[model samples]
Target: MNRKVIITCALTGAGDTTGRSEHVPVTPQQIAESGIAAAKAGATVVHVHVRDPETGQGSRETAFYVEAVDRIRESGVDVIINTTAGMGGDLYLDPHDPTTFVEGTDLVSGVERLKHVEKVMPDICTLDCGSLNFGEGSLVYVSTPDMLREGAKRIQDLGVRCEMEIFDTGHLWFANTLVEEGLIDAPPLYQLCMDIPYGAPADSSLLASMVAQLPEGAHWASFALGRMQFPWVAQSVLLGGHVRVGLEDNLYLSKGVKATNAQLADRAKTIVEAMGSSVATPDEAREMLNLRPRS
Candidate 1:
């Protein structure tokens, strides 16, 4: 097993998790502070997703991203910033009237989604590789091949590292296609998202099968939602992959035990060290991932 593993803390996801866990940061200040705390707790990178301050719902507002990034940079933390460019692809179609889009639908062109990333130029940006059945009943996250190609092109043009997010096995095929098409840069990075409904399940066999499909020389990490979050850290490390943990993916230290982002990072760090593996610092991670050094 690789002893030096990079840990990424997904501070807050674009989900309705704030109501469930009081520790999930909602505002720009809270999100930025949580990022800093995670960095100090041994997270080399922070995966960010902004939410509406009032409703606590996920949003793709440029102002929110600007404020969050500014606060994190100003805090003097040494964590690599990775913003979500996977929003604006949610397709909530009406069940009866498929032709009519739902109220929550935030469908936009792939290029539009990268607007914030173009402006902020974070160390890394995520590109969700494919569409999948989100939860149940007609709800789907649409990421067509054309859209993925377009997004990958824009991300590459910005000179930012793209963290390809694979939700299923087919998504990995699409990511490999992007690499073949030269849309993604060399030494690709991937995030194996597991245990989301209708996607790849969080299990050893499935994780191993997914890991085995990774392209050669690719840097990757894996995370599972809810209870599987911490356990996957050890599983990923054992499979020669990196680990990601935070309140976004999970908010509990145990059954009914609430946890903050920093606390989660600390717990993951302890597990990594106990497994005879060390956490990679921000600078070291940058080097390994070939990311542009943080200014």
Candidate 2:
């Protein structure tokens, strides 16, 4: 029964969703515009993942991040920026031999992954807690414990809040360990990711279980993919957590209806208000998340 829920709209994600939606922003300018639009539509925070302009695929280029973030910051919008440090751990293996790296593979050292986070210096950045079989392909996400420790330490030293992205129950376990080891600061923030194929399923009961495992007084948010996105808004608020929406997790405003990032954020705001809670403003969100603005 949380009264003030924070709405984080993930502007663009490192997924194969570019071809699926016309609204999925590819270039840096489009991504920045989408972030601003989502903020004006009632999102307190915007999660960003830059994409290749030509191929519309996920890109780990620091220049893309720089351009997008610079545009958003220069817009004078009062929204918290959260960049994704989850890019470089991708593992595309050969179908015949898993030992051999394939074309789409982009595995790098943990600190190497945060190259942009280090340079861009956003208010907040994500640290994916563990690995997963990314999708229905030979692709796997590899975020080992060592990687998590190093990334967590780096983000901490950078004076940026680390949003531990837990895809499954076990990832939550390791995330707690990071807290215990003092890698992440107190009242750590977490994003309980749900319904990414082969990860945590998007079930209410499972979400409750994960909520029960959260650190005391920790700030957290949860999201589901596709059609379950809207429902999870109510689900998360009812469970005393925050909510996330936007093109990163889902692309539809309704069945047969393509959605812009702002539309999804507006819909999330409507749902939260309907649930008898108000969406937090960016300044309020920063206060709740212990985030400070950068100059």
Candidate 3:
């Protein structure tokens, strides 16, 4: 078990959870504030995803990213920033015609999805290891091998760390292949996403299986959605990995108590302390992950 663990708070995700809980931050200012609050609450890292201010749906606007990132940097806080590059890959296959792309489809090249990442220049950016059926029905998240190579090359050139997000075993396998090909740099970072529909379930055995396959000297974190979020925090620490929690993965701190990003981070801090292990600060996390110096 890791004696000291790092906590990453995902501020908001690309899901339609704005109406589900009023605590979800919509505007750029709110997102930045939420991130700052989480950082102050003991989160070493903050994962950001921009949402449409008017609609509360996932948006890829570079202007929105600029505002939010600028706010975080100028907040006098020390949390590491991790921007999502998992957007613009959602594919909605029409039930009537397989060849006809549906209206909800936001398909784009892997490099195209990093438009905001390039402009904002966060400390880290997500690189989803592989594609799979996102959920039930015909909807799928497409990330071909070639697309991944393109994204990885560009991300490497930019001098930003890539957090490889593995949703399934196959995805993990392909991610290792990328490492073998030297696409991903050494001491790679991985985020084991659990309980996402049609992917790896939120089970102990499954998480163990994935953890056993990680590359040597990998810096990693794991999280599950909904009620399993907090439990996974303890589990990740026990398994020698870090933890992630926030409104993006779980909305409720308890059965029905809606939680803000700060509240979630606070609870995670409690859990980590209860287990007799302390949470790492941003500078500590940076040293542990061997992060590149700020530009």
With candidate 2 superimposed using the best TM-score fit, by how many Å does residue 70's alpha carbon deviate from the native? 0.9
Show model 1 residue runs off by greater than 4 Å.
none
Query: What is the alpha-carbon lDDT for the whole of candidate 3?
Result: 0.92
Off by over 4 Å in 3: none
Candidate 2 has an lDDT of: 0.93
Please write out the lDDT profile of model 2 over residues 73-162, one tens digit for every residue. Answer: 999998899999998888898889988998978889889989999888998999999999887989899999998898899999999999
In candidate 2, where is summed lDDT lowest over 10 consecutive residues? 286-295
- What's the lDDT for candidate 1? 0.91
Model 2, runs deviating above 4 Å: none
Collision pairs in model 2:
none
Clashing pairs in 1: none
> Predictions ranked by lDDT, top down?
2, 3, 1
**Model 1 lDDT tens row, 1-295:** 7688999999999887888888999998899999999999888889999999999999899999999999999988788999999899888888999988887788888889999998888999999999998997776898899988989999998999999999999999899989989998988999999998999999889989988888899988999998999899999999998999998789899898999899999999999999999999887888888988666
- Candidate 3, 207-232: lDDT as tens digits: 98899998899988999999999999
